[model samples]
Every structure is written in structure tokens, then in C-alpha cells.
Target: MSIQITTLDSGLRVASEFMPNIETVALGVWFDVGTRNELPKQNGIAHLLEHMLFKGTSRRTALQISEEIENVGGHTNAYTSRDLTAYYARVMHQDTELAIDLLADLIQNSTFDATELEREKQVIIQEINLSRDTPDDIIFDYMQMAAYGNQPLGMSILGKPEVIAKISGADLKKYAGIHYCAPKTVIAVAGRVDHAQLLDWVKKYFGQLSPVSDAPIPPSVYKPENILINKDSEQAHLSLALPACGGKDPDYYAYSIYATLLGGGSSSRLFQEVREKRGLAYTVSAFLSNVDDTGLLGIYVGTAPGEVAKLAEVLREQLVDSSRNIKKAELDRAKQQLKAGMLMALEQPFSRAENTAQHLLTFGRVLSVAELIEKIDNVTPADIHRIVGKMISAKPALAGIGPKKSMKVWEKFELT
Candidate 1:
């Protein structure tokens, strides 16, 4: 099901996608996050505030927040990303009002108790430690740093230990009061939803949320670099990144097709050549990270210490070869894989709700499945060649963690 939207006088957006046969509904409130919106002292404030919301509100305690939803056989959750922080719920259709009211209450009335802040702070610090210990997880953070260099887009959302320790309850309240305004908020629902009823509930609970004056964040400036960290490991972790277009760019679809043909799945070039054929690595894949004003297209591989050089050379060879020799059959397979992935995502209520919010925030409207499929269908071999040429024409940001000898292979131009 596709979505319909209505904007409130308070500036909050309410959207719904109705699936008649389903008894459950998924709904969420999205914020137009100031991704680069915080001051230098406020690096991880956006994510810190997310954890605080569930701790307590003026109307209910933290346990009550969990008990209320679970008692009703519904689940509530939240997540923070580079550009957005969302609070979501999945519930039986009849319980939609309760879900909406609880979510609105959490956003508007969260009290940020001091004791709760101290406790949650430790939890997050532990989280930061856990991320550091996971080599695969930490490598992407390094990759982003190499991609955007000193910009907010490059900073880890989990934040630095010192910064998280410094964030206070008052800090969370101040940030929320300004950035979590009605204008920055969106309420999206999918599955067995009644638009009029949903709108009425939203207006009653969210109508009073006031708008805040916000200044535009400076666009991220990309200054790609190469970073390598020496460590003791069984395998060398490699991440190769190059600049790419944002969500709205005309070439975004073509870029997606290009990446798919390059190594998006097991049957794609990187997987087949690097793993299935020569057995150089167990995990080799290409992916895209598209955000508001800019994006990165990267390929990651984990290979043996002795084979790291071969893997790096092969990766460069595939990029250069595929840009010139991509065939129609290869393009067709990538396009079919991409289209099927999108269409299959539409059936899940959570995914539908996410797409509704994401599209509304990005394009100011939701794109239908038919529209998306048509775009994927139109990408051809020539389009892949042209786009891949653009992707591989520049010096890429290389990030790696392993023995210094093996990781250094990525810093040389011999592969080209």
C-alpha cells in the first residue's frame, strides 16, 4: 500500500499507508535532524537525547513506558542515524490511538531525570567500548572519517567517551526544545490505518508542539584521505570509499545499478571473483551510504594477511574492467535483483512505515512501487559504464585495520 499525508497547523506531518487485510499497524515520529546541527561541544548530543527519552517522562516512569506497551501486546523502539532519530511502535490496529498518545507523550513530556541521566550515561559508555572491540564495526567509523574528514558527517553517532560523559540532563532538554519542534517531526503509519481517525488523534496529541527557530547547517565538505591502523588480527579489514551523489541526484538510480553489478550480491563481480573463484576472502561486498547532501559508495573485504595485496589489486581491476566492459545481461541481473529487493520490502509494515517517513523527509513525497520499478528498469549497460566511470575516476578513501605490512598495500598506486 502507498501513503497519503497531511500537514498540521502545528507543522507536524501525519502520513498513513492502509493495508486492509492486516490486523497490525506500524507508526513512527521522525525528526528533521540537524545532522551537522550541533555545536563542537555537542558532538553526540543528538544520539544522547534519544536514549534519554525512554528513561522517563513527566507523566510516566521508564518501567511504565515499557509495561504500557507490552501489556497491550505491542512493542516500542527507537534508533538514531546520521540524519534522523526516530521513535516507533507496532500494535494491533485497534490500539493505534494508545500507541500514538504514548509516543507523543514521550517526545513532549520527557523529564530527563538526573539520576536516570547518570545511569544511562554509563550504559552508553559501555556501548562505546563494545564498538571499539568489534573490528568490523569500528572500520566503518574509520571509513567515514576518511570520507568526510573533520565534518559532522564523519563523527561516530555513538560519540567519544569524554563527550558522552560531559552531556548533562539540561543539555538533552535544551537540544530537544529547539530541534524536536513540531516542524521537524513526522508521524507515519502503515497497515489497517484509518486516515481520518489517525489524523484526529495526531491533532489532539501533537497539535500543541511548537515550532523552533533553526539555522541551516553548513553542507559537508568532502576531503577524502587514506587511514590504516596496525593491529593483531586473523584477517585484514579493507574499506574502499569514493564520493557519490545524494538521495535526490538524477544519477542515484544509475549509481545503484552500477554498484549492484559491481558486487551487491553473491552473484555480483566482487563476490564471484574475490571469493567464489580465487577464494581470497570470505566476505567481499559493495554498498552505498546515501544521506541528505552527500553520499559514499564503498566496497569492503576481509582477507588473509598474505592475500591482502592480491585482493586490493583485484578490486581495482574489477572497477576499471567493469566500467568498460559491463554487459547487458549483467545489467539485467543487477536491475532485477534491485527491483525485487524493493518490491519485497513493501510487504512489511515496518519497512513501509520507514519508506513513508524517509521519502517524505527526503523528497517531500512518497514514491510508489511502480515508479521505483520503472526507474530501475530503465538503467542500461551504457548507463552502468558511464556511472562507473565517474565512480572510479577519482582517488578513493581507503581504511584498513590489520598488520601494517598488509594494510600498506592499499596506500600505493600500483593497483591502478
Candidate 2:
């Protein structure tokens, strides 16, 4: 439960939490660049670079990277998101140094070989086609596109097949060189480890890398007016989004409670009203996505083609009603659920490490578990109602994939 933070002379910020009873350590390097940092022509380069980094580095082949970690019984992987790309490894406490070196080499010295780039391009294109074939996956991307419009935040992390095909080794190298600097990266480790020893290892490995000038900020804010996409599928995939609060917003915790009450679980209002009582759909839920500058409150549902209209109508009614007359008992349950979820997540070391690094990256400091718990507990029914009032006043962007008839029926549920 004790955490330590340090800043290396090289500009890499290192944070660690000591868990004396644990036998494994989770370490990660988070780069503060993703789709939002890409220019129009380089939409998917950050994600592509994630794939390429694993392909090979100047010091080792891709298989060699895999073998080295597996030989130690360690696991390694990476992911790209709208705002960051992360490379992480979990290993026995004794293997922490080896893990650190391997991650450092992959990030700082990746070769981005031309042959490998061509092969990976085809791999990603196949991935894009695969996503298109899956209705549930395809609809969320469309929802993001509709919510953010033409902004970088709206662009797909996988990029278009045509665009991904054109991404060459040169593009990968240029983007990596510009965005992957010490100032834009955070190295985080948690579990059984010595904080001083971890700092020394980071200094030895990453200290020599220089910082980049003019680090890019994330894309400008742009909330869409309204948008819809038509696709052929068995059931209709529907998503509605309105811009909400980010991490720093005063209403951020209140919005989380609001979202939970709206559609968090089986007992949630969306499920109880839309599915359990009315039999409108098989699946329905809501989520709060809080980014650096802005956030989104989204509602998603999958239903029979003929029931899409009914589902949307019920969802709107629930939204409007919740804002108008949220019961005190329901509000109390939502707060307890959110607090319990947050407390449970803190029990895992990996979650703790990630929570530490992401808050540092976004807010420049981490809020303690006590602070977060208190914030959630303090959100009264009145607070939620006020936030809901603001949410209802804003226009929501919608996306759907299903029969042509369902696509046209959304006009009836349009936000005014």
C-alpha cells in the first residue's frame, strides 16, 4: 500500500508501489501518444508501431523476444488506445532487471525493418476485415466516429485498410522518433521490488535517451452534432453518446454514479426496464469513458431487427425519467456499487500500477484510494440530478448496424 515516485535526470518519470507479500512484479512503459497525436495521413501509425515494436528490434528477432520472456516464465504484451500506447511485462520479482532491459531495448531500439512492415501491414488489413465482419465490434468504432466526427479522436486505431496498406517503414520510424521521447513516457512498476533498485535500473537503461522538442498535445475538442451508419446484420447494434466530463472535471465521479445507475449491471435501470420487464433486447448497458480533456457517456444495446425502435424509445424514456425523478435509494445503491468496484480493483497489483501511471500521465498526480472513495461517497442524489440535467441538454451522436429498416428508424429517436 506504500508508493514511491521519482523523476530521472533523463526525464523519464518512474513510480512504484511496494507489496511485500507478493512474489511477482508488474512493470510497464506508457507512451503518451496514440491515435490522437496522428496527423490525418498517419491515422493508425501509433498502433502500427506497437505491432512493429514486437516484430523485431536491432538486438533481437521477434521470436527471440518472445522466447526470452517465456524462458523465464514471464508474460509480455502491448496495447494501443486513443491516448496512450503501453508495453508491459509481469514476472517473478527476481527477473525484474531482465524484464526492464528487454522493454527498454524494444522501445528505444526497434528496427522497423521494411520486410517486416510489409508483412505486418497485410496482417493488420486482415484484422480490419475481421472487425468489419463482427457486428458488435464494428458498431463501437462507428459510434466513436459519430461522436467525434472528423477529429483525430474519431479516427479508428486500426485505420482503414487502404491507409494501413500505405504505411511503410519510413512512416513508422518518423512517427516513433518524434513522439517516443523521455518527456512523454512513464515507467511504472509494482509488487515485490525495491524502489531505489528499480530507479537505478531505469536510470541505467533509459538515462541516455534525449527528449524531443515541441511535444504534441492531444487533438482539439469536437463533439459531433448527429451521425448514423447503416450496416447489414441479424440484430441491430445501437449506441448513443453525449460529451461528458474528463478526469479533472468536478462532476467526474458524479457522472460515474449516474452511468452505473443507468446501465451498469443486471440490476441496472437499462437492463431492468429494457430487457427484464419489457423484453426489448438481450443485451443493454451504459459506460462512462473519461479521457484527458473530455469524456463520453454512452448507451449500447443489441436487439432483434424489429425491436430496434422500441428499444431506443424505452432507453430514451429511462434517460429522461432518471434525470427527472431518480430515487434516493437507487442513488445510494449506485454509490455503493461504484465504491465497491473501485476498492476491489485496488487489490490487484497490475491494476494499481496502471492506475498510478495513468493518473500521473493525465492529471500529473495520483489521487489516493481514500480520496477517490470519499469523492464517490459524497455524490448525493442532487449532484447526480444536476449532472443529468446537463447531459440531457446536450445533443447525442448515435450509431447503428442492422437491417436497412432499423437504420432508417433511428430518425424517430433523434435528439432535438
Candidate 3:
């Protein structure tokens, strides 16, 4: 029921949250460099490195890495995002050492074989193809491009097939050497654990990392524009976005509450108005995203091609209405929802570890549940109104995938 943080001499941040009742622990090595750290030619190198690391390490073969974890009744997984990359595992408390060693090996001793690197490129190309086939998924990629132009932050993490095809084993090693150093990395653990023992384990295995490594990431610039993709799909997947605050901004919590009340769940405004009352779309939701220096408040919907115009009209009205007509009841409901979700995550070791790593990287400290709840509770109706009003004032970037005829429908839709 307590959290402890320590900085090793190598500049690595080891953060752990102790839960006395749990029998399992979750731990991970999180690196702050991701897609944004890549050069334009090396678009998907971060994700490619993630796959290559698991292919094999100097101490163990690919099969050995998987077998060792599964044999102990534990599992390991990793993901690469726009801002961070994580390799984590869940295991019984007694197997914590094995998990830590396996993670350490992947980062410090990986031997990116040439044969494996070539195979992984094809695998990622297939992944890219699969994503393209998914309309709802790919629309977001298009929306990102429209939002931030051709910059690193706006690029898809999976990368383009042509770009990935040219990346070699040397590229993976070079990228890792640059970004996987002590200064930008965090070793986060949660659940039943001893903080002192955890630090000892980290020092033994991760002591080799260089304490100083420069992270030169290009700044992200938000440029709102429109994008349209014509496909023979049955429904139109549409996304709209407006600039918002970064994760450290004072208004971050207020923006979170604003998005929740807008379309976080079935009871929220977008779901009730678009799906229940008018029956215009099957899936509709709003999300808030906060990156390093910028963020977005976005709304997404999938509807029949013929209903695009009506959907746009209703969205405009709802966006405007939320600013002026938000009631105390709605604000209270959103606050409770945020608080409940935050508290529930505390019981999940994996979620707790993930949030802990992210909080440290973003805010340079872990936020207490009390502090988070107070922030959520302090968001007044006026805060919501102010956030909504500011969001609506900016021109929105619109992205869609559907029939060609619907292109004109989306082109004419405006929400500024």
C-alpha cells in the first residue's frame, strides 16, 4: 500500500508500489524514446527494435526466452508507442528474479541476427497490411498525419513497408544504443515485493548501461488539416481533432473530464445523442491524448455513408451545447467515473506498473491516488465550459475512410 522510488548511480529510475495482499508482481523496463526519436528515414525503427530484441539475446535463444518465462507460469509482453517502449512481465512473487533477468538480457545482450531481422521486417509489413485493412484502426493513422503533418509524432508506429524493408540489423543496434541508456529508462515494479531486494536485482543486471546518453527528439508541431481515404467499406469511419494541453499542463485533468462527459461511455453525450436517440452510428466515442508538448481532444464515429452530413451537424451542435449547458450532475458523474477507473487500476499490477512508469516520465514523480482524486473532484462546470469553449475555437482536423461519394460530404463538414 506504499510507493518507493530510487535513482541508481547509473541514472536509472527504479519505482515500485507495494501491495501487501497480492501474490504476483509485474515489472518492466520502459524507455522514453520511441517513434518521435527516429529520423524520418527510420520511421518504424523503434517498433522493429522491440521485435528484434525478443528474437534472441546473447545468453538465450528466442525459444529459450519464451520457454523460461512460461515454464515458471509467467508471461512477458512488450509494446512500442509514439512516446515510449515497454517490455514487461507478470509472474508469481517467487519468480521475480527470473523476470528481471530476462528483461535485462533483452535490453543489454540482444544479438540481432541478420536472418531474424529480415524475417521480422516481413512480419511487420504484414502487421502494417493488417492495420490498413482495419478501417477504424487505419483512420486514426490518417488523422495523425493530418494533425501533425509529416513529422515524427504524426507518423505511424508500425512504419511504412518500404521504409521498414530498408532497415537492417545494424539499424536496430544503433537505435538501441542511442535510446536504451540509463538516463531515459525506468525499471518499474508493482505488487508484493521488497523495494530493497528489487534495487539490488536491478543494479546487478542493469549496471552496465551508460549513465549519460543524449536524447535528441524533434519537436512536434500540430497543424490541423483534412484527410480522406476512399474505400469500398460499408461504413464511414470519421475522426475529428482539436489541439489541447500537454500532460503536465494545469488543465489536463479538466480536459480529461471534458472528454469523458462528451463521449467516454454509453451514458455520455455523443453515445446517447448519436447512437441512442438518432441511431446514426454504431460506434461513437471521444478521447483525450496528451503527448510531450501538445495533445488533442478527438471524437470518432462509424456510420452509414448517407448519414455523414447528419452526423456532422449533430456533432457541431453537441460541441457547442456542452460549453453552455453542462450541469453539475453531469460534472459529478464524470468525476466519479474518473475516480473509479483510477482506483480500479490500483488493483491491477500491470496497469499500476504502466501508469507508474508513465507518470514518472511525464511528471518526474508518481501521483498519489489522493492527489489524483482531488484534481478530478476540483474540475468544476466552469472548467468544463472553459475547456470546451477553447477546444471549439480551434479549427478541427477531420479524417475519414469510406465511399468516394462521401468524400464531398466530409469535405464540406466544418466544426470551427
Candidate 4:
């Protein structure tokens, strides 16, 4: 497989990986604008705009857009995150042109009709309600809010219900005009794609967009704070987070290994200690999310309400133990697991395409699979110890959803 990247005169970036053996193409556009880019009052505008883009464009109705793709046996979807909004389609290699044109039209020239805006407001409100109904979803939002307080990074991507209801078509268009510039967008394609043809299509579809004045980049703020939400539920949801490395941080690889050893799988410390040995919780895991300026090492577990205290105790013990001393064997295992997962994910065309685009956007270049494995393998036991020490020193922010009594119980067993 070979990857080619080009920047059009209009500033849109096109990156493609040719997979001649495959018959499908996964193509997408990524915008570096999401909830974090919104003004205080326009909190949910980014996500709302994402939804409206698919509703209709200057050339096609929502139903027409769906039907066109389905007729070609293609699939299309979109998502909004803390810092980006993405729209993607997977189709037969022969239909790449149609997919690109449809995506470009939806993102760049959406009408955002008044009626459509009102209709989408209800849809988003329902989405918010649905999120609240799911404990797993709500818990993460709460944990993020607790970690960053009221900063832009802390705000929910779904935005507040009241604010979402008031988002106007004008708001959507204005925000889109400002942040959805060619310079801040990328077109990524993989699987049975020709780089030259993809670049030609990108230029034809996206070159018309006029560049806008660059907006100031927002600083990602990470505050050490704890928040607990009292709810009537059978299982208590607990999340603990500490500020860590970003995508560009030098310790990025080390931190990934650290997270894997902490709670990545069933053999991980948190899982084995908190669940296997003590039977304190049924589900436990750890993950790392690296943004532009900052990152987070987050641990989450769902356990019986009565076992919240024991769960917290065991988690703290494991954390402190790891921070003080991580065995060389354990460190090697974590590195192997991290590298193995990276290699496995690269086999999928969609994953490869997305990985290439994200790496290019964030790091200015993509690291080859072999280079990534080498980096992971080079991490020493001392590297793991140093990362863990930094994490331990950075007081973690905790978020819990369950009975108020559990909060009181868990609070008594803070990380020492």
C-alpha cells in the first residue's frame, strides 16, 4: 500500500491510501470544528450543523441523498466530537466520485433551511434525552465535566437542551462559514483508490470554498476537580482522570503503554485487583484521549452500589502500587499489547484511512506501522515508572453516578 497527499490551491487537504486488492473505498471529510469551537450561547451549533448538513443541500433533499447512496450499495454517516466533525461514506470503488460529490455538497453548501433547523432542534433535544437515559453515556459526560470544569473542553458535545432549542439557521451558517474553511478540512480516502483521481475530485468539489480569516486556537484547560451525580441505579459508575500527554507529547507512546498496564484488559491491574481478586466490580477499564494541547488518562468501572467503597479502595491501591513500582515483565507485556493492537487495526482500510488523516492533521505526518511498533518496543521499564509517577502526582479528578451514599463512602478512600 502506498499513500499520497496533496494540498489544493483552496487549502483543502486530500490524503489517499491505495489498496489495489480491495473493491471498496472509504472516503470522508473531516472538519476541525465541533462543540469546542462554539460560542457560549451557540454551544451545540457545531453538532446541530452536522445533523442539518445531511438533512438537505442546495442540490438534494435528505431522502434523495439517502436513496442515492443506498441505490449504489454505499453507506454514509457522520459524527461530532470535542474538536472535530466528520462525515463519511463507504462505497464500491466505482462510485467514489458520487460519494465525494455528495459529501462535499452536504458539508460546503448546506442550505440549513429554517424549517429544517426547527425540525433538527427537536431531533437533538430527543438525542439529549436519550443520552440521559443511558448511564454509560451520561457518565462519560459527567467525568469530562468534572475533569475540566466549565471549560470549552469540558462541555458536552450534545450541548445544553435549552441552547440547542434556540440554535438558528443563521447561527449554523455563520459558524460553518468561520470554522469549516478549506485550510481546516481534510478529504481522506482509502481502499482501491487512485490518489490522482481522488485529488482531482477533491479539487473539483472543494476548490470553490473561499478561505476565511483564521480563528484563534483555543487552549485546552485541565482542572483537577471532582464531581458526583446522585442517581437511583443498580450499579455505581465511577470515573477517575488525570491530565496526561497529547498527540504531540513526547511521552505519548509511554503513556499508552502505561494505560494498557493500568486497566486496558482483563489482565490489567485495575481489572484484576478490583474485579477478579476482590469482586468489587464487574466492568473496569482505562483509556487515554489525547487532544490538541492536553490529554487525559481515564479509568472507569461499573460495580454494585454496595461495593463502591471496596472498588475505590482497590483502585487506589493498584494505582499507588503501579506508580511506586511496575515490574519489567508487566511493562514489556503492556508494550507488546499496545503494539499488537496498532498492527491489528492497520489491517482494516477504514482504520488505516482515518489513522492517516488524523496523524497528518495532528502530527504533520503519519508514522509507518513498523516505526510505531519500534517506538513502543523501545519504551523501557523506567519510562513506564516515570509516566506513572507524573500521573500519580497530578491529582486526579473523579466523577461518579449513583446513590449519594456511595459518594460519601468512596470519598473517604481517596488516592493517597
Error of 4 at 223 (Å): 1.3
lDDT by residue (129-206, candidate 3, tens digit) is 999999999988888888888888789999999999999888888788888999899999999999999998998889
lDDT of 2 by residue, 1-416 (tens): 77898977667789999998899999999888888888778788888999999888888899999999999999999999988899999999999999999999898888988898999998998999999888788777787887887788888888888888888888888788788888778888889989999988998887545666466676556475445556666788888887788878889999999999999988899999999999988989999976787888888899988998788788778877777788888888888899889889988888888888898888888889888888888888788778887887777778887788997887457544
Candidates in order, TM-scores: namely 0.97, 0.97, 0.98, 0.97
- Superposed model 3: Cα runs more than 4 Å off: none
TM-score top scorer: 3
State which candidate has the highest lDDT.
3
lDDT at position 280, candidate 2:
83
Question: What is the lDDT of every predicted structure here?
Answer: 0.85, 0.85, 0.90, 0.84
Candidates sorted on lDDT, descending: 3, 1, 2, 4
Which residue runs does candidate 2 get wrong by more than 4 Å? 225-227
- C-alpha displacement of 331 in model 2, angstroms? 1.6
Q: After superposition, how far is residue 395 of candidate 3 from its true place, in Å?
A: 1.2
Which one wins by TM-score: 1 or 3?
3
Model 3, residue 249: distance off in Å is 0.7
lDDT of 1: 0.85
